[model samples]
Target: MENSIQSIPQNWYLILSSFMFCIGIMGVLFRRNAIIILMCIELMLNAVNLLLVSFSSYAGNAEGQVFVFFIMVVAAAEVAVGLALLVSIYRNIASTDINILSKMKW
Candidate 1:
Protein backbone atom coordinates (compact mmCIF):
# COMPACT_ATOMS: atom_id res chain seq x y z
CA MET A 1 0.00 0.00 0.00
CA GLU A 2 2.78 2.38 0.84
CA ASN A 3 4.54 1.62 -2.41
CA SER A 4 1.32 2.02 -4.36
CA ILE A 5 0.65 5.40 -2.77
CA GLN A 6 4.21 6.51 -3.47
CA SER A 7 3.94 5.48 -7.14
CA ILE A 8 1.52 8.21 -8.06
CA PRO A 9 2.74 10.42 -10.90
CA GLN A 10 4.03 13.92 -10.04
CA ASN A 11 1.52 15.76 -12.20
CA TRP A 12 -0.65 16.34 -9.16
CA TYR A 13 2.03 18.56 -7.71
CA LEU A 14 2.08 20.58 -10.89
CA ILE A 15 -1.68 20.92 -10.84
CA LEU A 16 -1.68 22.15 -7.26
CA SER A 17 1.01 24.66 -8.04
CA SER A 18 -0.90 25.91 -11.04
CA PHE A 19 -4.03 26.39 -8.97
CA MET A 20 -2.14 28.30 -6.31
CA PHE A 21 -0.52 30.47 -8.95
CA CYS A 22 -3.89 31.26 -10.43
CA ILE A 23 -5.29 32.23 -7.06
CA GLY A 24 -2.36 34.50 -6.46
CA ILE A 25 -2.81 36.14 -9.83
CA MET A 26 -6.46 36.79 -9.09
CA GLY A 27 -5.65 38.23 -5.70
CA VAL A 28 -3.01 40.51 -7.14
CA LEU A 29 -5.38 41.82 -9.81
CA PHE A 30 -8.48 42.16 -7.64
CA ARG A 31 -7.08 43.48 -4.40
CA ARG A 32 -6.25 47.12 -3.92
CA ASN A 33 -4.02 47.02 -0.83
CA ALA A 34 -0.29 47.13 -1.65
CA ILE A 35 0.55 44.65 1.12
CA ILE A 36 -2.05 42.17 -0.07
CA ILE A 37 -0.68 42.34 -3.60
CA LEU A 38 2.80 41.69 -2.31
CA MET A 39 1.51 38.72 -0.32
CA CYS A 40 -0.16 37.37 -3.43
CA ILE A 41 3.07 37.62 -5.39
CA GLU A 42 4.83 35.74 -2.62
CA LEU A 43 2.17 33.07 -2.74
CA MET A 44 2.79 32.62 -6.46
CA LEU A 45 6.52 32.30 -5.92
CA ASN A 46 6.00 29.73 -3.15
CA ALA A 47 3.74 27.70 -5.40
CA VAL A 48 6.41 27.66 -8.07
CA ASN A 49 8.96 26.61 -5.48
CA LEU A 50 6.75 23.76 -4.37
CA LEU A 51 6.45 22.58 -7.95
CA LEU A 52 10.19 22.85 -8.50
CA VAL A 53 11.01 20.89 -5.36
CA SER A 54 8.46 18.23 -6.12
CA PHE A 55 9.83 17.67 -9.62
CA SER A 56 13.41 17.73 -8.42
CA SER A 57 12.73 15.09 -5.78
CA TYR A 58 10.73 12.89 -8.10
CA ALA A 59 13.21 13.06 -10.97
CA GLY A 60 16.30 12.86 -8.79
CA ASN A 61 17.52 16.08 -10.37
CA ALA A 62 19.56 18.61 -8.39
CA GLU A 63 19.19 21.43 -10.88
CA GLY A 64 15.58 22.12 -9.98
CA GLN A 65 16.49 22.24 -6.33
CA VAL A 66 19.30 24.63 -7.12
CA PHE A 67 16.87 26.85 -8.98
CA VAL A 68 14.59 26.82 -5.98
CA PHE A 69 17.46 28.13 -3.85
CA PHE A 70 17.94 31.01 -6.27
CA ILE A 71 14.23 31.67 -6.28
CA MET A 72 14.25 31.87 -2.50
CA VAL A 73 17.02 34.41 -2.59
CA VAL A 74 15.11 36.51 -5.11
CA ALA A 75 11.95 36.25 -3.00
CA ALA A 76 13.79 37.46 0.07
CA ALA A 77 15.17 40.43 -1.80
CA GLU A 78 11.75 41.20 -3.24
CA VAL A 79 10.16 41.23 0.19
CA ALA A 80 12.81 43.50 1.63
CA VAL A 81 12.59 46.02 -1.20
CA GLY A 82 8.81 45.85 -1.38
CA LEU A 83 8.38 46.46 2.33
CA ALA A 84 10.84 49.31 2.26
CA LEU A 85 8.94 50.96 -0.56
CA LEU A 86 5.65 50.43 1.22
CA VAL A 87 7.05 51.98 4.39
CA SER A 88 8.26 55.01 2.48
CA ILE A 89 4.93 55.36 0.74
CA TYR A 90 3.11 55.20 4.07
CA ARG A 91 5.46 57.72 5.61
CA ASN A 92 4.70 60.23 2.93
CA ILE A 93 0.99 59.55 2.42
CA ALA A 94 -0.26 57.99 5.69
CA SER A 95 -2.46 55.64 3.64
CA THR A 96 -1.70 52.42 1.85
CA ASP A 97 -4.43 52.65 -0.72
CA ILE A 98 -3.02 51.95 -4.18
CA ASN A 99 -5.40 54.27 -6.00
CA ILE A 100 -4.84 57.11 -3.61
CA LEU A 101 -1.08 56.79 -4.09
CA SER A 102 -1.29 57.98 -7.65
CA LYS A 103 -2.70 61.30 -6.53
CA MET A 104 0.10 62.03 -4.09
CA LYS A 105 3.04 64.24 -5.11
CA TRP A 106 6.56 64.26 -3.74
Candidate 2:
Protein backbone atom coordinates (compact mmCIF):
# COMPACT_ATOMS: atom_id res chain seq x y z
CA MET A 1 0.00 0.00 0.00
CA GLU A 2 2.78 2.41 0.99
CA ASN A 3 4.90 1.76 -2.06
CA SER A 4 1.93 2.45 -4.33
CA ILE A 5 1.42 5.83 -2.74
CA GLN A 6 5.06 6.91 -3.03
CA SER A 7 5.33 6.10 -6.72
CA ILE A 8 4.19 9.52 -7.86
CA PRO A 9 6.40 12.47 -7.06
CA GLN A 10 5.11 15.40 -5.01
CA ASN A 11 6.30 17.77 -7.72
CA TRP A 12 3.63 16.46 -10.09
CA TYR A 13 0.89 17.32 -7.65
CA LEU A 14 2.21 20.82 -7.22
CA ILE A 15 2.46 21.30 -10.96
CA LEU A 16 -1.04 20.02 -11.59
CA SER A 17 -2.50 22.20 -8.87
CA SER A 18 -0.72 25.26 -10.16
CA PHE A 19 -1.93 24.61 -13.67
CA MET A 20 -5.53 24.19 -12.49
CA PHE A 21 -5.40 27.37 -10.45
CA CYS A 22 -4.02 29.35 -13.39
CA ILE A 23 -6.77 28.10 -15.66
CA GLY A 24 -9.34 29.09 -13.09
CA ILE A 25 -7.87 32.55 -12.82
CA MET A 26 -7.85 32.96 -16.57
CA GLY A 27 -11.43 31.84 -16.86
CA VAL A 28 -12.60 34.22 -14.19
CA LEU A 29 -10.75 37.09 -15.78
CA PHE A 30 -11.67 36.42 -19.38
CA ARG A 31 -15.19 35.05 -19.13
CA ARG A 32 -18.04 37.52 -19.05
CA ASN A 33 -20.80 35.13 -18.04
CA ALA A 34 -21.60 34.88 -14.31
CA ILE A 35 -22.11 31.12 -14.38
CA ILE A 36 -18.82 30.41 -16.11
CA ILE A 37 -16.99 32.58 -13.61
CA LEU A 38 -18.61 30.74 -10.74
CA MET A 39 -17.55 27.42 -12.24
CA CYS A 40 -14.01 28.69 -12.57
CA ILE A 41 -13.98 29.58 -8.90
CA GLU A 42 -15.06 26.04 -8.13
CA LEU A 43 -12.23 24.75 -10.30
CA MET A 44 -9.75 26.79 -8.33
CA LEU A 45 -11.11 25.44 -5.07
CA ASN A 46 -10.85 21.88 -6.32
CA ALA A 47 -7.25 22.48 -7.33
CA VAL A 48 -6.43 23.63 -3.84
CA ASN A 49 -8.28 20.67 -2.41
CA LEU A 50 -6.22 18.33 -4.54
CA LEU A 51 -3.02 19.95 -3.39
CA LEU A 52 -4.07 19.68 0.25
CA VAL A 53 -4.88 16.01 -0.07
CA SER A 54 -1.62 15.26 -1.82
CA PHE A 55 0.40 16.99 0.87
CA SER A 56 -1.54 15.29 3.64
CA SER A 57 -0.95 11.88 2.13
CA TYR A 58 2.70 12.54 1.45
CA ALA A 59 3.31 13.82 4.96
CA GLY A 60 1.51 10.94 6.61
CA ASN A 61 -0.69 13.41 8.50
CA ALA A 62 -4.38 14.28 8.50
CA GLU A 63 -4.16 18.04 9.03
CA GLY A 64 -4.16 18.99 5.36
CA GLN A 65 -7.07 16.66 4.68
CA VAL A 66 -9.00 18.30 7.53
CA PHE A 67 -8.38 21.67 5.93
CA VAL A 68 -9.62 20.32 2.63
CA PHE A 69 -12.91 19.29 4.28
CA PHE A 70 -13.41 22.77 5.70
CA ILE A 71 -12.64 24.28 2.33
CA MET A 72 -15.15 21.97 0.70
CA VAL A 73 -17.87 23.10 3.12
CA VAL A 74 -17.14 26.74 2.41
CA ALA A 75 -17.07 26.13 -1.34
CA ALA A 76 -20.43 24.42 -1.19
CA ALA A 77 -22.01 27.35 0.62
CA GLU A 78 -20.42 29.73 -1.85
CA VAL A 79 -21.85 27.86 -4.83
CA ALA A 80 -25.31 27.77 -3.28
CA VAL A 81 -25.32 31.49 -2.55
CA GLY A 82 -23.67 32.41 -5.81
CA LEU A 83 -26.15 30.49 -7.92
CA ALA A 84 -29.05 32.01 -6.01
CA LEU A 85 -27.71 35.47 -6.67
CA LEU A 86 -27.18 34.66 -10.33
CA VAL A 87 -30.73 33.44 -10.66
CA SER A 88 -32.01 36.61 -9.10
CA ILE A 89 -29.89 38.72 -11.42
CA TYR A 90 -30.94 36.78 -14.48
CA ARG A 91 -34.58 37.27 -13.62
CA ASN A 92 -34.12 41.00 -13.35
CA ILE A 93 -31.89 41.56 -16.39
CA ALA A 94 -32.63 38.50 -18.54
CA SER A 95 -28.88 38.03 -18.86
CA THR A 96 -25.89 36.81 -16.86
CA ASP A 97 -23.21 39.08 -18.27
CA ILE A 98 -20.94 40.69 -15.70
CA ASN A 99 -20.69 43.97 -17.55
CA ILE A 100 -24.45 44.38 -17.43
CA LEU A 101 -24.36 44.09 -13.66
CA SER A 102 -24.00 47.86 -13.43
CA LYS A 103 -27.68 48.12 -14.36
CA MET A 104 -28.63 45.96 -11.39
CA LYS A 105 -29.02 48.98 -9.15
CA TRP A 106 -32.53 50.34 -8.64
Candidate 3:
Protein backbone atom coordinates (compact mmCIF):
# COMPACT_ATOMS: atom_id res chain seq x y z
CA MET A 1 0.00 0.00 0.00
CA GLU A 2 2.81 2.35 0.79
CA ASN A 3 4.45 1.72 -2.57
CA SER A 4 1.19 2.22 -4.39
CA ILE A 5 0.53 5.41 -2.58
CA GLN A 6 3.65 7.09 -3.90
CA SER A 7 3.68 5.69 -7.45
CA ILE A 8 2.14 7.42 -10.42
CA PRO A 9 -0.81 5.95 -12.26
CA GLN A 10 -0.13 3.87 -15.36
CA ASN A 11 -2.61 5.89 -17.38
CA TRP A 12 -0.51 9.00 -16.96
CA TYR A 13 2.51 7.24 -18.30
CA LEU A 14 0.55 5.96 -21.25
CA ILE A 15 -0.71 9.41 -22.11
CA LEU A 16 2.70 11.01 -21.77
CA SER A 17 4.43 8.36 -23.83
CA SER A 18 1.81 8.55 -26.51
CA PHE A 19 2.19 12.30 -26.70
CA MET A 20 5.94 11.99 -26.97
CA PHE A 21 5.64 9.37 -29.67
CA CYS A 22 3.28 11.56 -31.66
CA ILE A 23 5.70 14.46 -31.46
CA GLY A 24 8.49 12.22 -32.62
CA ILE A 25 6.44 10.97 -35.51
CA MET A 26 5.53 14.47 -36.55
CA GLY A 27 9.13 15.60 -36.40
CA VAL A 28 10.29 12.68 -38.51
CA LEU A 29 7.64 13.29 -41.11
CA PHE A 30 7.90 17.06 -41.32
CA ARG A 31 11.58 17.78 -40.75
CA ARG A 32 14.24 17.63 -43.47
CA ASN A 33 17.39 17.76 -41.40
CA ALA A 34 19.20 14.45 -41.04
CA ILE A 35 20.30 15.13 -37.51
CA ILE A 36 16.83 16.24 -36.49
CA ILE A 37 15.38 13.08 -37.95
CA LEU A 38 17.80 10.99 -35.94
CA MET A 39 16.93 12.88 -32.80
CA CYS A 40 13.25 12.32 -33.45
CA ILE A 41 13.88 8.62 -33.88
CA GLU A 42 15.61 8.58 -30.55
CA LEU A 43 12.69 10.44 -29.03
CA MET A 44 10.29 7.82 -30.34
CA LEU A 45 12.43 5.07 -28.88
CA ASN A 46 12.49 6.83 -25.54
CA ALA A 47 8.70 7.09 -25.58
CA VAL A 48 8.47 3.36 -26.06
CA ASN A 49 10.97 2.84 -23.29
CA LEU A 50 8.94 5.05 -20.99
CA LEU A 51 5.79 3.05 -21.69
CA LEU A 52 7.61 -0.20 -21.11
CA VAL A 53 8.95 0.95 -17.80
CA SER A 54 5.53 2.07 -16.71
CA PHE A 55 4.02 -1.25 -17.65
CA SER A 56 6.79 -3.13 -15.87
CA SER A 57 6.32 -1.08 -12.75
CA TYR A 58 2.57 -1.44 -12.86
CA ALA A 59 2.90 -5.20 -13.02
CA GLY A 60 5.73 -5.46 -10.54
CA ASN A 61 7.80 -7.27 -13.14
CA ALA A 62 11.46 -6.81 -14.08
CA GLU A 63 11.24 -8.00 -17.67
CA GLY A 64 10.27 -4.60 -19.01
CA GLN A 65 13.24 -2.98 -17.37
CA VAL A 66 15.57 -5.62 -18.81
CA PHE A 67 14.08 -5.07 -22.23
CA VAL A 68 14.56 -1.36 -21.83
CA PHE A 69 18.23 -1.98 -21.14
CA PHE A 70 18.56 -3.93 -24.34
CA ILE A 71 16.72 -1.24 -26.22
CA MET A 72 19.07 1.42 -24.88
CA VAL A 73 22.05 -0.64 -25.98
CA VAL A 74 20.61 -1.00 -29.46
CA ALA A 75 19.77 2.70 -29.60
CA ALA A 76 23.33 3.57 -28.63
CA ALA A 77 24.71 1.37 -31.39
CA GLU A 78 22.28 2.85 -33.88
CA VAL A 79 23.29 6.40 -32.97
CA ALA A 80 26.96 5.52 -33.32
CA VAL A 81 26.55 3.99 -36.76
CA GLY A 82 24.12 6.63 -37.91
CA LEU A 83 26.38 9.49 -36.85
CA ALA A 84 29.32 7.86 -38.58
CA LEU A 85 27.38 7.63 -41.79
CA LEU A 86 26.22 11.19 -41.41
CA VAL A 87 29.81 12.32 -40.97
CA SER A 88 30.81 10.54 -44.16
CA ILE A 89 27.93 12.04 -46.05
CA TYR A 90 28.59 15.52 -44.71
CA ARG A 91 32.23 15.33 -45.75
CA ASN A 92 31.19 14.53 -49.30
CA ILE A 93 28.42 17.12 -49.65
CA ALA A 94 29.12 19.59 -46.85
CA SER A 95 25.45 19.36 -45.87
CA THR A 96 23.32 17.10 -43.70
CA ASP A 97 20.05 17.67 -45.42
CA ILE A 98 18.18 14.54 -46.43
CA ASN A 99 17.05 16.16 -49.67
CA ILE A 100 20.67 16.70 -50.66
CA LEU A 101 21.58 13.06 -50.08
CA SER A 102 19.70 11.94 -53.19
CA LYS A 103 22.51 13.38 -55.31
CA MET A 104 24.99 10.85 -53.90
CA LYS A 105 24.31 8.32 -56.62
CA TRP A 106 27.50 7.23 -58.29
The parts of candidate 1 lying over 4 Å away from their true place are: 1-5, 103-106
Tell me how candidate 2 scores on lDDT: 0.95
In terms of TM-score, which candidate is stronger, 1 or 2? Answer: 2
**Winner on lDDT (1 vs 2):** 2
Ranking by TM-score: 2, 3, 1
Task: Encode model 1's per-residue lDDT on 8-58: one tens digit a residue.
Answer: 778888899999999999999999999999999999999999999998888
In angstroms, give how far residue 20 of model 2 lies from its true place.
0.4
Per-prediction count of colliding residue pairs? Answer: 0, 0, 0
**Candidate 3: regions farther than 4 A off:** 1-7, 103-106
lDDT of 2 at 34: 93
lDDT of 2 at 78: 97
Q: How does candidate 3 score on lDDT?
A: 0.94
**What are the per-residue Cα lDDT tens digits for candidate 3 across 1-106?**
7787257677888999999999999999999999999999999999999999989888889999999999999999999999999999999899998887775677
Instruction: Give lDDT tens digits, candidate 2, residues 1-106.
Output: 7597778899999999999999999999999999999999999999999999999999999999999999999999999999999999899899999998875676
Give the better candidate number (2 or 3) by lDDT: 2
Residue 11 of model 2, lDDT score: 96
